[model samples]
Target: MNFPSFGFGSPWVLLLLLALPLWWVARRRRPPSAIVFSRAGTLAESPRRGQWVPRLLFLVRNLAIAGLVIALARPRSGGRTEESLSDGIDIVIAFDLSSSMLAEDFQPENRLEVARAKIKQFITMRKNDRIGVVAFSGEALTQVPLTTDYPVVLAAVDNLQPGQLEDGTAIGTAIATAANRLRSAPGRSRVIVLLTDGVNNRGAIDPRTAAQAAGQFRIKVYTIGVGSRGLAPVPVGRGLFGLRYENRPVEIDDSLLTDVARMTGGRYFRATNAQALDEITREIDRLERTPARTHTYTRYTELFRWPLGAAVLALFMELGLLAWRAPLL
Candidate 1:
């Protein structure tokens, strides 16, 4: 009752279209002709059998084209559906919301901006894994819970703005919050990405203590220190007159970050710029992998009859055209 085929099938069908030109050639007028023959009157007696030859040839040509079109369609028969393995992991981004994160040191965008960009790239590379979000500054906040929807996670990353917290950097609190949400996850591979510019200064919990909690939950934590060494410029001027502001050296405590990573059986990275941050995220992405399962269905429909019929019709047309145009030798 129904038939299925490839949408782009039978491009050769255009060849059968040659019939249009063959018909056109039939309608075209022939110039007046004078022929020298044994008997000129006999020419008229030969009958217009020549016209029938083209008609038969055109039919044969159309049949050939039709056969080619059918062949290209690649018709198949039968259908199947099944479910199989799908692999992925669980990921959470714990971003800093402290005021210092707003400092522009890596060129172009600031530290937070660089972190956001890297997180987005990392999400695209992840597969079969649920993800969550956590943002912290002087305090810690859960932005999103673990879910397979990477789009929602990416949107959360974009909304991370500075000065959300009043204290300072609470690396421990951020890690703790992220690990807590992932502690009871159904997926086995759980990971926390803690990004900050400074050491744990505001939270009651120390960075090491939080990392220990993460480890107890079997959560891997990758700590990242984002920013360059030495002083970076700050815009402290007003109007074209340019008032002027003080310059302060940029500071990052890599030791604490490294210790937190080691405590949780993870790695610590220092990103001085965008490229380093991107590479670090990619490296982590490669490290965590969880399995997933997916379902799929395939269908096919037999097409031999069409091509067989075409071959017969072309043979018949060719025979008919030859017989109809036969001349006396």
Candidate 2:
């Protein structure tokens, strides 16, 4: 829950509090008696009933004075509000799920697993942007359309597996599918982030042709090559106990990826490990930010009425007590 900000409009009025002590001392002093009593010691010898009545009246009167002083300060509560006055960017993520992505180059987790984790983090970092998801192997499939709903995008990324589609890297197809999704998106700028771990060999469209098509629509495409250098452990077949692993040479077409990025006025990134992948995503986030202007406003509500009422009520109570117990006081 958000709390309102509290403050006084006329804070200088609080200096009146300094005079309270002087008033108290003056009230405590007794004036000289007009007539002297010779047997006054006899009255002093007996205990006085309701001796605390005067003290109680003084306390009530002091409370009333304090409340009135605070009311004069013009206390109020305020709340601040902000509004954004710009459109957000539209982005589509093209994820590769080919067999090569299963390579355990990032240790403990496969390349695809680490990529999924990083992509999920990337999705959460974006604000007010509509994001879409495209899953591709031998062919491309749109897992989600452009939307501001992030949970649905994260769920689609988590559910992607190595064998969900045909067992080949369709880099060109993935780019084409992502560009199609962003062709008429609701934003001034449209973007595609395609992460692949292998060379293109299955798609009907050529990688360069797809990049040109994206360029025609003025959509920026950021390509990412994911994997470590040299060999990486991969699952080949299932054994009696569990899945079996075999080291395989890492393969990623850097030139084609770079060309695709350049043709669409974007940049190509190489992620050798998990840390590098994380850094690449952060860099992309910094590059394609939506410009926005924010306007802030503050609303204040007067709270002096409450303190004023309290002061009035305390004065009434003090007057009633003085009338009922005048002799005791």
Candidate 3:
């Protein structure tokens, strides 16, 4: 099995290792006991025995000291697992895909392009939250389902285009579709962010009725009216060479959106530009956060016992050998 990182708990205790050399020097300098040999010739004639006892005893002494030092530097391995206390909020973004979204009044790009960029940014910020996407025009469709997998949501948002759906604003159907997705979500808080730049002109259900349904299900509905007030550049037609642009009046039903938000216990926001859209998303992010409970724990296995045991056994063996080899006095 793979083990976690290993380290010493009391590493400062390892400084005691410096004394091992000093001890060895002291042992070497000590004077050896003198032995008188009245009959040197007879002793030389007797069978010689190995003189390795003193060296063996010295090795044992050093090993005992080393083991003790290692034991002092406590060692352990592994890491703690922590559970997040903040629960994620489930969100569904209902995007407008009507032809009016192609208007270029927002600058460098059209309303749909700017909205897509801001939506991507919003998804990036809420990494822990589960998000889904719904694209609406004359009809509503679930582009992506609720999921923590952010890449799928981002991809769906990036692929949004005006001509994919029938060209009409179905604000009511969009809300109802988004609410259906959130009804079964497991998060503590469920929300739908509806973005549009036109008045509701299609679908059987009314926008207010859909908002009431969301309220009944305890889901929040934040509505955003996207576009600059007054005349904005719009693509009228394509000639022999390229597309043609003309100044047309911008039309956003902010009153209906505000009413929808009021019915669902949510807020309505007006985004005249890209920056305002970003700010509106950030505000919704702050409002959707709910408190959650979490748990955390840590486990460690100590390794000091092995070295300490070795130190004791080595010291005992050394003492026993010395006592057995000592001459009678």
Please tell me which predicted candidate would have the highest lDDT against the true structure.
Answer: 2
Model 2 regions lying over 4 Å from their true place: 1-83, 292-329
Candidate 2: deviation at residue 8, Å?
A: 31
Candidate 1, after superposition: displacement of residue 144 in Å? 0.9
Give Cα-based local distance difference scores for all models. Answer: 0.76, 0.87, 0.86
- Tens digit of per-residue lDDT, candidate 2, span 1-329: 23458888888888898889999788669673443223355347654545556677788888899999999998888855788676478899999998778888898898888999999999999988889999999999999999989999999999999888988988889999999999987577899999999899998999999999999999999999999988888778789987677998888999999999999999999999999999999999889876655456887788999988998999998999777664332
List the candidate 3 regions with Cα displacement exceeding 4 Å: 1-82, 293-329
Residue 261 deviation, candidate 2, in Å? 0.6
Model 1 segments more than 4 A misplaced: 1-82, 234-245, 292-329
2 or 3: which has the higher lDDT?
A: 2
lDDT per residue for candidate 3 within 1-329, as digits (tens), equals 12466777778888898998898898779775453222355347653332355677778888888888888887777744577877578899999999889889788888999999998999999956789999999999999999979988999999999889998999999999999999988777899999999999999989999999999989999999999988998777787887677898888888999999999989999999998998998998888887655556677678888888998999998889777663211
Q: After superposition, how far is residue 308 of candidate 2 from its true place, in Å?
A: 35
Preferred candidate (TM-score higher): 2 or 3: 3
Candidate 1 lDDT, tens digit per residue, 1-329? 22343332344554554666766576565442344223335457774425445555656766766676566555445644568887867788888877677677767887778888888888878776788899998889999998878899899888988756675888878888998898998777789988888767788888888889889988999988988778865444445675343466767889898898999899999988889998899888777766766567775455656775786779777776567553222
Task: Give each model a TM-score.
Answer: 0.62, 0.63, 0.65
